[model samples]
Target: MHPPDKNPHDMRTAFRREFASPEVWITRTVVVGAAAVAGLVVVGFTWLAEQALGLFKGIASVGWWLPLLWTPLLCGAIVWTTRRFARGAGGSGIPQVMAALDPALSGGRRPLLVSLRLSLAKIGLTSAGLLGGLSLGREGPSVQIAAGVMLTARRWLPRGSGVSAHSLLVAGGAAGIAAAFNTPLAGVMFAIEELSRTPEQRNSGLIVSGIVLAGLIAVSVYGNGTHFGVIHPGPIGLALVGPGLLVTLVTGLAGGLFARLLLASLRGTSPDAPSRWRQRYPVRFAVGCGLAVAVIGAVTGGATYGSGNEATRALLDSNGHVPGGFALFKFIATWLTAWSGVPAGIFAPSLSIGAALGHDVAWLTNYPYAPAVIALGMVGFLAAATQAPLTAFIIVMEMVDGHGMVLSLMACAVIASTVSRVLSPPLYTALAMIQLPPRRTLPLATAGGDTDDSATRP
Candidate 1:
C-alpha cells in the first residue's frame, strides 16, 4: 500500500540515518566512556582499601598492645578530619546517593552529598576506618565515589543534552557494584531495585549500556572470576530442603533483629546511658568505639577486624573454623563502628556475620552441605538487612556462583525479607529519610497584614 518512492530500501536508509544522528551518537559515547572511567576509579579505590587494611594488619601482628594505642589515635584523627572538612561524607554513602537522586529531598543540594571533595574524603576516611580495625566495608563508599565521577564527567557533555544526572548516578552506582563484586547482573538488578524505581521504557538502554561497559572494563583488569571462589554443591536433592528452611528461619530472625537494633539506634530510641552519652559527644564516642573494637580484636586475637574478608573466605573454602563467639563479637563491633558516626559500610561485615552463623548452624546440626547452608544464610541475612530480596539473593548467588541453589536462595531471601519488613523498614530507605529536610508551613497573612491564627485552619 506504500507509494512507489517509499520502498523498503528507502525505509531502511531512513532508519540508518536517524540512528546515526549526532545527538544519539554523542549520548551513547558519553555513557560508555563515563562507565569505563567509573570502573577504573572503583578498581583503584578497592586496591587502596586493601592496601590500607593489609598495612594495619601487619602492624597489629607485630605487638599485642599496638592496636590499643593506635586505634584511638586513628579514630580521633579520622573523626577530626571528617568533621573539619567533609561533614556530608561520613557513613556508608548509600543514603547520600539515594538523597542525591531524590529531587524533593535534595532541593538542589545534591552536590553537597557527592562532590569531588566528598568522594576523596570518603575514600581516605573509610580507608582509615579499615586501618583502625573497624568492622566496615569499602563497597558502599565505592558506589558514592563512582556516582561522583560519573556526575562530574557529565559536565563535559554539551549543554541541554538528552543525558540526565539521575541516569548517570544510577548507572554509576550499578557500575560500582559490578566492579566491587564482579557481578554484572546483580549490579543491574540493584540499579532497578534500589536506585531507579522508574519504568524500563525510560533510559533503560543507557543504564544497561553503562553497566555493561563498566563491567567489561573491570573484567579486563581483574579477570572474569566471581568475587568469592566457586563452590559446587553438587545436585540438589530433597535432603537440602529441611536444612535450607532452618537456615531461612534462623538468618531471618537474626538479620531482622539486627536491622531493628540499627534503626532504633539511629532513631535515638535507645534508652541506654552509653547511647545517650554517645549522642552527646560524638568525637569521644568515636574514640570509645575504636577502643572497644581494639578490645574485641585483642580478645579474639585479631579475628574481629577489618571487613572480615579473610574469615569469610576461610569459611567459604571450608578450610578453617571460626570460634563460636566470632559472629556475636563481629556483630557488636560492626554495630559500634556504625554508631561511631564514621565513614564505613556493613556489606562485607554482614556477609561475614552471616557466614559465621551458618558455620555454627552447620556445626551444631552436622549438616552434610555446609557450603550450601552458608550461602543460604548469606542471602537470607543480607535480604533481611537491606529488605531487597532480589538484590540480596542475586549478589550472593553471583559471588558464589551458586546457580544450582537458585530456588533455595530465592526462598530464603523472600522469607528473610518478609521477616525484616515486619521488624523494621529497609535500612537504606530509613537512613535516606534521616537525611531529608523536615517539611514546614509558613503562616498565611491577611490583607490587613495580620497573620491568621486559627488553630485548625486547613
Candidate 2:
C-alpha cells in the first residue's frame, strides 16, 4: 500500500498534527490566560480613561478658562515624561505594534517597541491625555497595551508550541480590539486587516481564540452590550442611496485629508516652522498643541475635547446637537493631539468627527437622515483613515448593532478607503515603516508620506 500513500493533504494527518502535540494545548492555555489578563487590563484602562475625562469635566465646570491652563501644562508634562521614560508609549500604540511585527525590523527593535514598561506608560499617559482635555481615545493605546501584555507571555510558552511571537502579538492586538470595542468579529478582522501586516498570521485559530477569549470579558462585563447601542437604520431604498453616496464622498475626502495631514504632522514633508517645532521642542510643542485644543474646546464649549464619546452617542441617538462646526473643530483638535506627540488614540475621535459630518449633511439636505447618516459617516471615515474597509464596517456594524445596514456600511467603507488611498498610503504601515531601521533593500517612496530615507530625516 506504499505506507498508505503518505499523503500530506490527508485530514487525519492534519488533525493529528494540530491536536496531537501536547505543546499546542500548553500554548493555548497560556494564550488564554494572557488574554484574560489583557481583558482585565483593558477594563481598568477604560475606567481610568473615564475617570480622567470626569476629572477634566470637573475642572472645566470650575471655570471655562481652566482648560487653557490645565491642558497645556499637563500636555507639556506628559511629553516630558514620555521622552524621559517610555517614548514607545506615545501615539496610539498601533504604529509601534505594526513596527514590532515587521520581521525585518523585529530582530533588534522589538524590545524597544513593545514591553511591560511601555504598556504601563501607555495606560497612564493615555489617560493623562484625556485628563488634559486632549481629543484622544484609549482604544488605540489599548491595542498596544494588550499586545505588550501578551508579549510578556512569550517567555513562558512551551518551546515548539507551533505559535510564533508574531502570532502571539497578533492575538494580543486582536484581543485588545476585542476587549476595547467588545466586538469579537471586528477584532479578528482588525488582526487580519490591520495588525497582521506580515505573512506570519497563518495561525488563524490562535488569533480567533484569542479574540473570543478576550472579547468575552467585555461581553461579560457589559452584558453583551455594544460600544454603540442598537439603532436600526430603515431599509435601504432609493431615497437613502443618494444621501449615502454623498455622505461617503464627503467623509472619504475628509478622512483622506485627515490621513494626509496626520502623516505630514508625523513626518514633515517641508521645512515648515510648526514641523520643526514638533521635532525640536516636543514638550513645548505639546503645550502649544494643548493650548490650541483648549481654544478649540473653549470655542466649541468642549465639543472637541476628550474622545468625543458622548458627542458620538448623542449624534447616533439624536439626543442633542453639538455646537456648529463640530466636525471641523474635532478634525483640527484630533490632528493637534496627534501632533503633540502625546499618548492618545484617534479611534473615537475619528468616529465622532464622522458622526458630526453625517449629522451636518443630514441637516443641510433636510433629508431626515439622522441616525442612519451618522452611522454611514462613522464607517466611512474610519475605513478611509485606517484603509481597512472590512474591519471598519464590521466594527461599526457591531457597535450600532445595525445588521440592517451591513451592506450599506460595507459599501461606504470600501468607497471611502479607496478615496483615502489616493491621498495617502496605509496609515499604520507608513508610520510603522518610519519606525523601522532604514535599509537600502526596502521601498522608500510612499504615496505622499515621503518616507524615502526616513531614518536620515529628522
Candidate 3:
C-alpha cells in the first residue's frame, strides 16, 4: 500500500536489523573471540609448562639431590600461596569446573571457581609443580584456565543476549582439551562424557564451533601431529591379542585401584593413617609428597617426574627399555601428588604410568610389539581412572596415531571402564559432588506477602 513513502532511515534500520541482529552478532563474536583467546592461552601455558619441565630436568641432570631440596620448598610455597590467595585453584581443576557448571551452585561461585584470578594462579602454580618435578600434568589445569577465559570473555557480551553461560563453559572446556591434546574429537567426547551431565540441543552447536575454532588455532601454532609420537604396528597378530587382553585386565585393575585410592584420600576415607594425617596437614603433606616424588625421581633416574610426556614419547618411538620399577615408582609418585592437595592433573602422569606398565608387561612377556601394548595400557588406565571409555580411547588413539588399533583400544577401554566402575565411583563426579553444598529451598513471596510450603519448593 503506497499510502505513505517509507522512511529511508527506517528502511536502513530494518535492513540492518535483518542482517545484523544484536543477538546473533553478540553471540557469534563472543564465541569466536573466546575460543581464540582460549586457544592462545592453552598454547602459551603448555609451552611454559614444557620449558619449566625442561629446566627442572636440566637441573636434575646437574645433580640428583637438587630435586630433593628444590621440590619440597617449591611445593610448600605453592600450597601456601594456593591456600592464601586462591583456594578454589587447587587440585586437578576439572572437579571445580564440574562444580561450577551446576545451575544450583554456579550463580555466585562461578566467579570464584573460574575467573581470571584463578586461571592465572592455576597456570603459575601448576607450572611450578612441574618445575619441582611433581608427578602432575597441565591438561586438566588447561581446561580450568580455558573455562575461566571464556567465562570472563562472556561478561563482555551485551546484556539480555541469548548466549548461555553454561554452554560457554562447556565449549570453553572442550576447546581446552582440544588445544591441550590437539585432539578435537577427544575434546568433544570429553565435553559430552565428563563435563556435560545432560546434553542440550542449544549448546551442541556452540560446543562444536568452539572446539573447531580452538583446534584450528592450536594446529596453526603447533602443527598437525600426534601429541605422543606415532607408532606403526605392522600387523595385528593373534599372538598379541592374548597379551593385549592380559594388559587390559592388569591395567584395568591397577587403574581402578588408583582411582579408589585417590577418592579415598580426597574424601578422608582412606584406611591408611598416613592419608588421614596428610589431609589434616595439607601444606606439610604437600611438602612430604614432593619429597617422595623427588625420591622416586632419584630412584628412577628422573623417569618418574613431571608429566611423563618424554618417557611416553620415548616408549612410543620404539625404545622399550624403561627402568624395571618405572611404572611402580611413577604410580606411587602420582598417588602422592594427588594426596597433597595442590594444583595438579593426573592425565599425562596417568598416561605415562600406563605406558610404563605396558612396557613392564611387554618386558615380562617378551612381547615384540611394546608400543602397541603401551597404547592399549594408556587407553585402559585412562578409561579406568576417568570412567569414560570413549574419551579415554579417543585421546590415546589420537595421541599415538593408532588408528589401526581402534577395535583393540575400544575393547580395552570398555573392559577397564567396567572394572573401574566395580572398583569405585567416577573420580571427577565424586570430587564435584564434594564441592557442591547440600541443596536448600528458598522461600518465595505469596500473593498475600506470606511464605508457604509450596512457595519454598524447588
Which runs of model 2 end up more than 4 angstroms from their true locations? 1-4, 8-21, 198-202, 440-458
Q: How do all models score by TM-score?
A: 0.91, 0.93, 0.90
Of 1 and 2, the candidate ahead on TM-score is 2
Q: After superposition, which runs of candidate 3 have C-alpha atoms over 4 Å from their true positions?
A: 1-20, 269-272, 441-458
Candidate lDDT scores, in order, read: 0.79, 0.84, 0.82
- For candidate 1, lDDT tens digit of each residue in 24-47? 677677878888988888888888
lDDT of 2 by residue, 1-458 (tens): 36665546888877887788788778878888998999889988988999999999999999999999999999999988887777677777888888788777645568677777889988999999999999998888989999999999988888776677788788888888888888888888988888775544445676688778888988888778778788857667888888889889999999999988898777755588887776667778889999999999999988888999899998888667799899999999999998888888888999999999888888877767578889999999999988989989998999999899978999999999999999988888888776666664543222112222332444
Q: After superposition, how far is residue 89 of candidate 3 from its true place, in Å?
A: 0.7
Judged by TM-score relative to the true structure, which candidate is superior, 2 or 3? 2
- Candidate 1 ranges beyond 4 A from true positions: 1-18, 199-202, 269-271, 441-458
Question: Which residue pairs come into collision in candidate 3?
Answer: none
Q: Which residue pairs in candidate 1 have backbone atoms (N, alpha carbon, C) closer than 3 angstroms, thus clashing?
A: none
Please state every model's RMSD to the true fold in angstroms.
Answer: 6.5, 3.5, 7.9
